[model samples]
Target: MLPYWRLSGFYFCYFALLGGVAPFLSLYFHHLGFSAARIGELVAIPMLMRCFAPVLWGWLGDRSGQRLLIVRLGALLTALTFTGILWRQDYLWLALIMALHSFFWHAVLPQFETITFGHLGEQSARYSRIRLWGSVGFIVTVVVLGLLLDRFSPAIYPQAMLSIMLAIFCCSLLVPPAPVAATRSALPGDGFLRQLWRPGVLVFFFSAGLMQLSHGPYYTFLTLHLEALGYDRVLIGAMWALGVVAEIILFMVMSVILARFSLKQLLIGSFILAALRWLLLGFWADSLVLLALAQVMHAATFGCFHVVAVHFVQRSFAERYQGQGQALYATLSGCGGALGALYSGYSWNALGAGWTFALASVAATLAALLLLRWMPGRAS
Candidate 1:
């Protein structure tokens, strides 16, 4: 229980940083007078780096049995690199800094998960109880930052974000190193690449990637879109926090939910909800009621889907390759998300919000179909 609380504290800090970035960063870039396409590029740059960085770092953590060291290093680098935003607001320089920051930031979580599961031992089903702290942190940051941004200048956004990153770095330093689980053992001579290509594994990765990709537009443009529709920062922040709050509730009950439903069912349900959620955002942007309802579905779209996917990865891979499995999941999701964000950015300018989100709906529907056809088994 102590370890759970400690890990939860780390999650709380880590995702609080994400909560700062996800809902507000696009608006910050928008305030800087960047065009929609340019803002998309700026936002996507970090995710692009995230696509590959986790694999390298995860491999090192697995090989050297130094998961906590990599997590701390990643957090420290993320804090330092993000400070570059204070010095350079030029699109190119900001993009480079964001990329470097994300490269390290992305590596931290998969290895952290490996550590977390090791600590959980046979109580893995209780992961959500701990993970819910992250959602709580996200909500706290989004709501507080939203209020702060509403009261203060948008120019202060990066400073506020930097403060959170600093705290996260400090928290990382406090985490006790997680010893390797007793299950760590060498794989067959066939290697990770071969294991990665197994039918269900490939399908799962691609499906999860597409699912995350579908979020690109929502994450990259939703704040700006709401602002364009005359919503204030506070309202925008509430909307963002609302989703995470719902996600928190879902995480709190995830073990029971998983017991009743298979991972495939949850994944498919999440994609279906995602498609509807985007369509609602696109067509009903002006309705607070509709927006609120759409936010609630994030429980399904992100929370349930994520837990099920993580469990699936844990069950699918050997203990020795656990970090690699998590890393691969992060890599595919990051790459797909980057592409989706970049594409949505270009389309936001050309097609407008309704059409751009409509496209995301389509992508999510496709992801749902793929999951239904390819991976029908329970996540066990």
Candidate 2:
């Protein structure tokens, strides 16, 4: 029997931690009197670690066939290192804590992705069903913490996040080991780098990176932006939840959508929707109807885009190179995200919120045009 619940449980706790951090971490820093730029810089630390750590960790998993050990160790270290945040809330101390904790935290997901795919084997279409639990976790945490933070202080955020990290460690314990992946079509001596160097795969990774670059403003500042506009904390959290809610709905029907739309088609649509969503948020943020509508676009921007990318990576590489392929995906996405966070950090104060999001819109548009030029529309 498949260890469905075990895998789902891990994704739940893991994403619940992410859900808490994304909306509240910057707010927590702001509460400590950090400027928007400082908060952005501090937030980018983990993302930067993500850019470099995965290659080493992914290689170890591929060679050793011990991905679960890495996942468990990563979870434990993430929690232990994160406890340093409570020691000092100063900018330097928080930066250290973010880097230490996130180096391990970021390493956990890519290895686990390889493990989860190995477990599924032939039932790959069911991937979305298990992954949707992650979306559910995101909604639950954001909504509950949205309510909690409204009643308390952002100072309480760290302890709450630590608890989720502990839960991730616990969930990691429940997931059993899966065998290393095996593929029928893998060539006898084709190397990982050779497969990754393909022109089509290069365009796909670059285009995906651009989409994540577009996300920098939204991830870093959307909560702060909403709060400044006088929206209550509960409403702000719900707004975040609203996007994931749409994503959950999409994940449920993703197989059907994929059957109808090519990955290239989905990628282009997602990029276009992302551009429009950022523009809506940037120009009309005060308009609740428009804000809510833009939030709903997360289904395409993240949900459909993510499903397509994961599938693309799984298909493009040979079985032995699967871990490295997933790692490369994370690396490119991380590089884009780190750059996005840095630019938004500097721009949030100097360029203003509207302009920062407009920049995001421009990045998404660039991604769409790039993909159109190179990524063939062949159904994948």
Candidate 3:
């Protein structure tokens, strides 16, 4: 058996923390009275660390064949490091803390992704089903916390986040190490580097990075933007939840969707939808109905795009290097996200929301063009 619950439980708690951060972290930083640029820098710290942390941990996991141990240690360290937020409120103090905790926290997901796919074995298409639990966690946490923050205060954010981190540590203990069964391709260690150098593979990574880069404004500022537009925190939370609800619905039928479509097709569709989605947010955000419709495009922008990306990484590398493959994906995406957050912060203040999102739309449009031209049309 696949220990489905164990895998799902870990994702749930892991993304519950994400749910807390994505919508509320900026609000928390705002409450701390930091400038927009400072908040941007603070948010970018973790992503900047992700540019290097995952590969280091992935190398260790692959070499030792001890993925579960690395996961536990990473989780525990992440929780411990985050508690430093309560220790001091200075920018330098939080900066150091963000970099430290993110180094470990970023290490967890890529390895866990490798392990989950290992568990799924021949049923790799089922990945979306397991991943949906994370979306579920995001929805529940965003909604509940949205309500709470509205009723109580944003100061409670840290305490709620701490509890979720502990839950993640506990879940890490429940998932046993994945069996090292034979992979579809048995490439030698040197072959992975060679495969990574392929032109098609390089283009795919670049496109994926662009996709995440386009999300910089959305992830970092959507909540604040909505609030500024006169939406209540509760409605903002519901809007966030609505996107995940769309993501969940997509995951439930992803196996069917992928069965009938190529990864190239899905990636192209995702990028195009992302372009339109950002444009909607930029030009029509004042309309609640239009905003809600735009949120539904999360099904393609994130949910489908990610499903295709994971499978692409799996196909491009041999089983022995799966950890490294996933790590590289996360690392590249992180770099893009860091740049996006930094630039968006500066732009959000200098250019305003309208122009910032227009910039994001351009990024997504460029990614779509890359996918259309470079991604192989054949199923892998």
Candidate 4:
């Protein structure tokens, strides 16, 4: 039997930790007296790990058929390695911690995603229903942590993340291994690499990478940017929460949306909206009304794009290649994210926030055009 709540519980803790980190981790580094450029480089370290770690782990998972064990091991090492942060706050040390922990952290999601789809079998449409819980968890943590940070020091951020990391490890213990039939490799004798190069796959991945690259400024600096613009911690947190709340609402109704629009249609729309969202942040973020409206665009940019990407990867690859397919997606996203981080780190101070984000908008718009050029009228 599928342990529905158990799977949901893992996502909850996983993203609840993200909820706290995504909106505020840069702020935490800022509080530690790291410059904007330093923060960007430090944050990019984990993303660099994400670029390669998932593929290595994914290969092991596919070969051994013990993906659950990998999940558990990744969870344990992630938490254990993160404890190094409590011992030192220096840049080199912090960079090492991010790299070590993220090497394992990046290992968890792809394997678990393969496991979740295996359990769902053909009823894959229900994925968003389970994934929305991740959005809820994001909202809960951001709001509650925001309130806490208003009164407390950002220095406590590591402690809070440590607690959540332990919870993720605990959640991993509850779920049984996926059924044997699901994990067994069913590699077609024709070979997986051939399937990968078949029309549109490479283009989809490249476009997806550009979209994540567009997020460089937003993810790396939004909280600090908003704080500099006179928003308080609690309000800043609410802003982040608002985006995920919108994401939750989208996940709730995704099936209807998917029925009406093909995944390629949704992906194109997501890129367009993301471009608009970055431009709004760059030029109009001081206007609370405009900012709020832009935040709501997270539904299309993240919520819809994510659901479609996962579904697309599942459909794109054969069962035996599933783990590697997901790993490739993660790899490209990590590469994009790492590049975004490095670029934003250098540009945020030199070019200023407005121009930095304007560049992000350009990346997203180009991604939208790539799809239109190569994939117009074709199904994702």
Candidate 5:
């Protein structure tokens, strides 16, 4: 049996840190007097590193069969490195800190995903149940910290984030390593490269990359956008938490969703919803009703999308190559997210929020089209 709670505990703490970063980090940079472009650059640094860092770490984890060890190391290094933010306030210094901190931080999750799946074995469909704890963690942090930020200064953000980082390090220690499958006596004739180059696989990755690309604006500046629209920090945080709360509900029912729907159906639906969500945020920022409706789509956009993605990756690769498979997904997501952040920064500054998110909508629409073209007939 899996050490369910231990694994879930790690996710809870890990995403609690994410909750701290995603919604508030830009606000922190803004409070420090950085412009939107600079904030985007700083945020993109970690994501840019994620593009390559995970593959390297995934390689080592697969070869060494020490994924949990890598997870601990990543957690410790990320926590240690992020503390450098306390030492400097300049853009260059912050960028450097982000680079160093992210290099290791990005390495942790993909490998941990591999470990979690390995633990689940044939019961892989239960992943969302284990994963929902992370959403709960996110909701807790985003809401509580949002309320706190309203009362206190945004200066408290760093200390609060550092505390969550410490918790992640502690969680990393609680879970044991996953058991390895015995190697096949004979290797496949097609090999890893051949499998990766397959048409459906390539399309899946390209489509997935576009999906993350569409999230650039949402993740980087949604809080600031809300603030600009006259919303308070508490309300902004509640809005962010609302999205995750919706995600939690989806995660709870994801097993049933998966059992009924094909991965193709879920992926297409997620992209379509993501496109609509971005459009709503772009044009309807002032409408609390529409904003709430858009937030609720997180159930489809992230929750359903991600659950299907995890399953797709697991089914795509051979047992021994699971680390690499997850790593590839992480790398592609990082690439999309990095580009999204970088461009969204420039677009938010030059073109404004509406156009920035409109661009995001376009990207997601393109992804859905790609999925439609390649993933037909429920083969997935």
Candidate 6:
């Protein structure tokens, strides 16, 4: 229980940093006078870095058998490098800083996940109970920061974010290392690339990538969109928190859901929810109730999808390749997210909000179709 608490604490701080960045950063970029396209580029660059960074770091962690050290180094370096943002406001400099920070920050999680599951052992079904702390942290941060931004200026955003990162780094110091699983050596010689190239894996990556790509517009422009619609920062923050709160509830019950549903079923359900969610946002941005309800779907769209996907990776890959398997998940999700954000930026400028969101709806639908066609009937 102490170990679980410690692991949960690490996630709490880690996601607190995310809470600041994901929900508020667009508003910050807006205040910085960045065009929508520029803001998208800024947001997407870090995600693009995530596509490759985790894979490299995961590989190294596996080779050295020092997952904890990798996690510590990644967190510390991420915090230190992000401080560079304070020294530069220029888009190019900030973009470079974001890329550097994301390169390190992205590596921290896949290895940490490997460690967390290791700690859970055969009781892995209880992962959601421990992981729910992250959702709680995200909700708390978004609500608090929303109030802060409403009362103050956007200039303080980076400082607030830096403080969270520093806290995350400090928390990394407290996380006890887990024992290496003995089954690490029993992994087959199927080769990483070969496994990655399998038809089902390839289809899964492409479909998941499309799903994330569709979210690019939402992540890069949601706050800005709300602001343009006359919503206050606090309200926007509430919307973000509302979604995560739903996610927390889902996490609390995830073990039961997983027991009843196949991973494919969860994945397909999430895509369908995502389609409806974007459509709601596209057409009903002015309706607080509708928007809030849409946010709640995040429970299905992200939380359930993530849990099932992580479990699938755990079941499919051997213990030795666990880090790499997680890394691959990060790569597709991150890179796809980056691409989605960037493209959304351009489309938002050119196509307008309604059409941009409509496109996202299309992407989500396509992902659902692909999942129906490609995902195996049974959990892999």
- Candidate lDDT values, in order: 0.84, 0.87, 0.87, 0.86, 0.86, 0.83
Root-mean-square deviation of Cα positions for candidate 4 versus the true structure, in angstroms: 2.3
What is the clash count of model 2? Answer: 0
Candidate 5 minimal-lDDT segment of 10 residues? 179-188
RMSD of each: 2.6, 2.4, 2.0, 2.3, 2.5, 2.5
Candidate 3 structure, TM-score to reference: 0.93
Q: For residues 257-288, write the lDDT of model 2, one tens digit per residue.
A: 88788888998899999999999998898999
**Across residues 18-50, which tens digit of lDDT does each residue of candidate 6 receive?**
888876788899999999779867876777788
Residue runs of model 1 more than 4 Å from their true location after superposition: 27-38, 87-92, 150-152, 179-187, 224-234, 284-288, 349-352
The candidate scoring highest on TM-score is 3
Write the residue-wise lDDT of candidate 4 on 1-380 in tens digits: 66789989999999998888777788899999999779877876777888899999988887877888999999999999999999999999999999999999998999888888888876678889888988888878887887787799898899999999999999999978777565444455645677678677888889878988989888878988999899997788678878888999999999888878887888999999999999999889999999999999999889999999988888787766778889989999989987887798789889999999999999999988888888647455
lDDT of 5 by residue, 1-380 (tens): 68999999999999988888877788899999999678867876777898999999988887787888999999999989999999888999999999999899988998899889888887888999999999999878877898899899998888898899889999988888776652221165756666677657888888878988999999878988999999997787678778888999999989999999888889999999999999999989799999999999989988999889988887777656667778888899889987887788789979999999999999999999888898756745
TM-score of candidate 4 on Cα atoms, chains taken together: 0.91
Model 2 residue 40 CA deviation (Å) reads 3.4
Worst 10 residues of 3 by lDDT: 182-191
lDDT of 1 by residue, 1-380 (tens): 43767899889988998888877888899999999779867876777788899899878987887888888888888889888988979988998898889888998899888888877777778888988998888878877898898899789998898888888778777777655553555466846777676656788899888888888889878888999989997788778878888999999899999888887888889999999999999989799999999999999988988888888887777777888999999999888887788788789889999999999999899988887787747644
Clashes per prediction?
0, 0, 0, 0, 0, 2
Q: What is the C-alpha lDDT profile of model 3 across 41-130, one tens digit per residue?
A: 787788789899999988887777787888899999999999999888899998998899889998899889988988888989999999
Q: Alpha-carbon error at 172 in model 1, in Å?
A: 2.1
- Model 5 TM-score on a 0 to 1 scale: 0.91
Top lDDT prediction, candidate number: 3
